[model samples]
Target: MPCLARWLVLLTLLSHSAAQENVGIGLDLSVGVEGVLPSLARPANASRIFHGIVFDAGSTGTRIHVYTFIQKDPAELPLLEKETFQSVKPGLSAYADTPETAGETVRQLLRVAKKAVPHVEWERTPVVLRATAGLRLLPPKKAQALLDEVEVAFEESPFFVPDNSVHIMNGTDEGILAWVTVNFLTGQLQAKTKKTVGTLDLGGASTQITFLPKFKKTIESAPPDHIARFDLLSTTYELYTHSYLGNGIKAARLTALGALGAEGLERKVFESSCLSRKFREDWSFGGLTYKISGIPDGSTGFTECYKEMLKVVKGVIHQPPELQDSNTFYAFSYYFDIAVEAGLIDERRGGMVKVQDYSIRAKEVCNKLSMYLATKPFLCMDITYITCLLKDGFGFKDETILKLTQKVNNVETSWALGAIFDYFQNIKIH
Candidate 1:
């Protein structure tokens, strides 16, 4: 073989070997990685361009965020240049029994990173995967088994794998990181007098609410765990944030239908008044298929649907008393998705919407389920859940204005970018 080809083969062999050696070794993220980051000497003439890969292992799907950054000055925070994104469906949790297949999905996504980042830069580009509510909802042993498989896939890749490259992210960190992403993208983080907007993200299995509280009383009144002191860009921010597990759109459906924790679901048919009375189907989530339907003899409308949704929302989530006083909030993910389906917001140029808009749309869709049956069977249930979640669950006023957005300045409005930024900050590259 040629010298270049032989060098490539040797690298592959070493990477595979390292992956095998690290199997089953867990890294507790609470402890800081003191000496794990690679110390590289940069040449004066070399370009300051670098890349970071973050796989957002979400409940609905697995998305890969390949971010490019340019360091204009060594003393300043690196600026995000561009981002490339792609996703695979059914999420990692769907592969609970097939952990190796979950690793295969990740490996396929790594191919996208390989194409996005230059081969010469692969060695230094750190690649990490942070599983969100999907894995968080899984049993501990099952979740760890999946993580172990993904960790091996990461180590076998050519990209730089950090000490804890694959693990389930806690709810608090998930909310705070998403807050960081939105604030950073909107330029709030760079401003001297930061008036940052709040963020509401509704995923498949969990929902998050985060904002920088202005009133001192709000901070004092909140639960101790809801407030976090996060340091980014040489500044510390005491932000109010929380991630409600099993409260996401899909998860809420199970909760409303009383199928979430019930055993022997495959043989039983869970009914919900939120759905169409004529509707019946098989819904699969987190590797289990469920038989669900609506009561044919019972009534179904927005009024009945809202009542069912409130059961999951009313006393479940803690309401931040001061959130109603906040001026602006950016709601995204499932919030944006459902709004588009209901024609409440534009798909491309996301617009500002009042909390009442969701209520109005929910009423319209729930009452007219037959019209949207072929296209969106769960439209009524989903919309109703959003309305109840915002108002009854989080205690937002109906008149409160929320900016529904999918992206800001061409980058996705998710936690992946914030995670990559946090990764670089912790490493402090020389």
Candidate 2:
């Protein structure tokens, strides 16, 4: 064949394969469903980049992003240009400190988004919308309210289908890690590092731990020097998952008022009541390290209170001793060895339940904690030291990860930033 003809054929084949890839649109938008933020919303300039809208609707504040991809179909030309809509409630703290206003605020923001972006396709391109993790935690009723508000804006947009075809995607730690491990081959934490075997997610409203196993990437690859290094080996997880449902501020507020009577505290006073009473009633405050009154003025005294509150929470959150005993170290280790020896890694899709390994690993972690940070092991380390280090390519201050946050509770890691970055990358293709 002629050289020109051959080159054209190869190029055509590549394009055909690329088109088959699943380049779906992703969306993330949230408004507080309860508390002071119920009426809050904000809008901002969005660009035509990816079919995504990543909203950082943390209790501290709200950020709206509506990124458009090259329209799959004609009619979305105007989105290529910048459009600015000011935030109705922009306080970063308000997203969390006062969630009651979140739903209302989000509704206000959506109105602005629709007004600023317009429903008609300016450039004649196909568009889609995606809502992510932050909004899913709302109660069914509250969630419906927020979704209803979005539906109004979605309906007005000609680009949106009556069926609300804009696919909604909320991220799970499992889904996030699946992408990370498969694509990035993120390997594993060094032995004794807190993040090995599982992930600890500490979000605005809740916290949870997810565990997986470490097997050879090739079923036959022998274990590496450190168990952490063995993460490069292919293993699976299905045993360790613990979520503190009412642990988040919103969850706390709802359950607390419901249990202790709604009048125990005013809207703003909810957190205080949690630290002193509601939290104490449920969790073991033995982990608490600071007192609110002892902190000086001008600083966020709440930060101090938050640390103590977390400690109090861990005291009471766990399985009965019987369940814990059933999940022993020897048991997990045995299962892991058998699975690897049996060449079951690929068959299971990394979803095996190494229930025993998860606990044994936890113990090994606690032992390492005593030596490295001079303290007992705590779940917070999963989010604190583990996720940040991986997301940032293992760049973080050991002082914060190992000592204050992990040991004394007077520390903060770049967890929110890490989550933001990870979430950002997943949704925005550009």
Candidate 3:
């Protein structure tokens, strides 16, 4: 089929773009959604380039990814040439009460996109914001309020705003897209032997695990929701993927302290064995405030902390039996950040580490709290939780090797890059 003809048919099904409302368009690529992004073919001497602006509305922060792609060959996938990235702290969910402020945050990030993308191309570029666990965990009304404000911001921008461009993203798509990002950048997608690695993303409010299962029993024994079948570039992938809500690092902290969803947090104090006995502080997450402290005179160490962390993971995360065998995985986001802090990986280059490395580091951090009190009060709890999540939650063996990294092939290893492919397939580049 001609490239123009393929996009015309896709645009018809995506006609909701004209409504300009905050609708949740499920890009369940699992159903083999075809390309909708325009293709431009020119003389061999001329080069065609296009841009995409994606806002990752995560729990801890909001980041803008301005991606520039060049179509060197009409017969091949576009090459990702460059990415201009910027971020702002305190995600949209923090402004749940004052929704207008959430809109302003997006507007602030738009300036980065404005500079990153050429002015002449502004009218043709498609801009979107996909809120993750942060907004998803918020109350329905509050989440909608934030999305409404963001939509208003997009409307005021110079860029093209597609229909349902601003909305909360489901976890299933989050995991699968992230997997696509890692595999795509590593050149695994085009290889003859499709030996792609799994992905593990630990955010502030949720964590996701996704991988292509090699054995038939892996898919058969899995829950129906855990299996996602999607086609990309004419290749079908049956992946085992799942995102654990309220199981992110920050949310897990509250659960370990017995503060998650607790009523009257203002009047009560939540204490945990995970922290030093002398530790006391106020923690804020998902727009709620809670006073948390450690036991005044109770024993504290890896043993006590591990017990608390285990409470949040045990029986909560489904352990795929196939994962017990050796398999490669690219762990990022919090996984990369914490690993760097624990000295298990290099801060710049990143490196490989076994699942047991986290446990060993967690024990060291927890056993010697005083050494890290000023700079890392929660390092003990945070690291221990990661250790528990991998072993007890996901059932990874101690010898399981994980490649921890912030980027692959110079592209930030994130679902944003994988997600932009859909927008590229849907929008007209001209």
Candidate 4:
């Protein structure tokens, strides 16, 4: 083979090996189940069968998800972290009876997938299975046996460990290219069009936004990832993505009441939920800043600090180009204001939730703003908001946003680099 071809082969092999090490899941896969992220760097240029099958033995039902990645352009079209999920009802679904049933489910899903994408080389692809919060809830022996049966049924590997990357708490938010905030921002500018579509992605644990232009494709991966991009309707665009950790519903409630402190505090998390331990320190999201103020030392452990974060993020909410009406900024601002009047809001005692509440009282603010702020990171809320924002906030209009995005793309000023510099300043790295 030619040198270039040989080099490509070598890289793929290396990447595959890396995949073996990186096979961890994340919070968005399910609630109450801790997720392990993949150690493998997201594929950038090759097409492969990257499948994730999840089994959550829950009180409600068993949930399962099967996703495949056609890595023709791994960097451009990675199977999203979003696609890695599905639910199963053990009593209702045949797959719940025995390992045999689970295997059958896999076979059935594969069959359907084959029909959808005939080019898939299923025989060579590897399938992976991991259980959620329920896994540990069951006796260890039982969990292991079930996992073993699942491994056998699906002809896949199973993992029982939870490795939360970034911070040691509130896990989730691994390698999705959103952490390189500056690059993510610059990439957005490059993807500018006539108008801007704000995406508010509210996940089980985190939230993010991706402003896309006309020439946008669904970006599935970020390789070498100095920067990140977004994909919409198979169109890819560089975007300014902002992510907030511990911003999900459960956490919202937990933090609201000052339950989850910095230490020994699980936050409003279900054991199987990936957000519990991942969100706190997940710096991998570029252009995304994860801030919470529930810490005791006015830090990431208490609700008071989180109230301040509400203040800090007001800048983003009130940014140029027409801020979203339903954004949390106003709610937080109003909540804080109320607390001040009632003398119940104290930044020192986690008593500012009132101030945080009223600031975002716009009737359709959160609902409408989701049109353009949605990214896959924020889970269910993200979907609702993004869908709502697109329909309501922008009134389902993309022409103006697309054109504006294109204009931003044309004006390249290295925002990402500047962001990095700003990051350094914040940290006093000099």
Best by lDDT: 3
Model 2 misplaced regions, further than 4 Å: 1-50, 54-62, 67-139, 161-201, 208-212, 215-243, 249-312, 315-430
The weakest ten consecutive residues by lDDT in model 4 span 164-173
- Candidate 3 all-Cα RMSD: 6.0
Error of 3 at 287 (Å): 0.7
lDDT of 1 at 384: 96
What is the Cα-based TM-score of model 3?
A: 0.90
Candidate 4 lDDT (Cα, whole model)? 0.30
Whole-model lDDT, candidate 3? 0.84
- Residue-by-residue lDDT tens digits, candidate 3, 363-413: 989999878767888889999999999999999999999999999988889
In the range 1-430, model 4's lDDT, one tens digit per residue, is 3222322332343234334444331112222212222223344443444432233232123434333334344223232222333344441122232545545544444444344322323432333333332232334554455555544545432221122100111111111222222232334323433343343333333344444323223223222221344332223445434444444332343333334333433233211111122333321111122342212222221122224234323322212233323221111111222233333445333231321232232222322323322232222222223223233332332222211111122211112222222221221110
Worst 10 residues of 2 by lDDT: 402-411
Error of 1 at 97 (Å): 0.7
All candidates: TM-score: 0.88, 0.35, 0.90, 0.30
Which one wins on TM-score?
A: 3
lDDT of 3 at 139: 93
Clashes of each: 0, 55, 5, 123
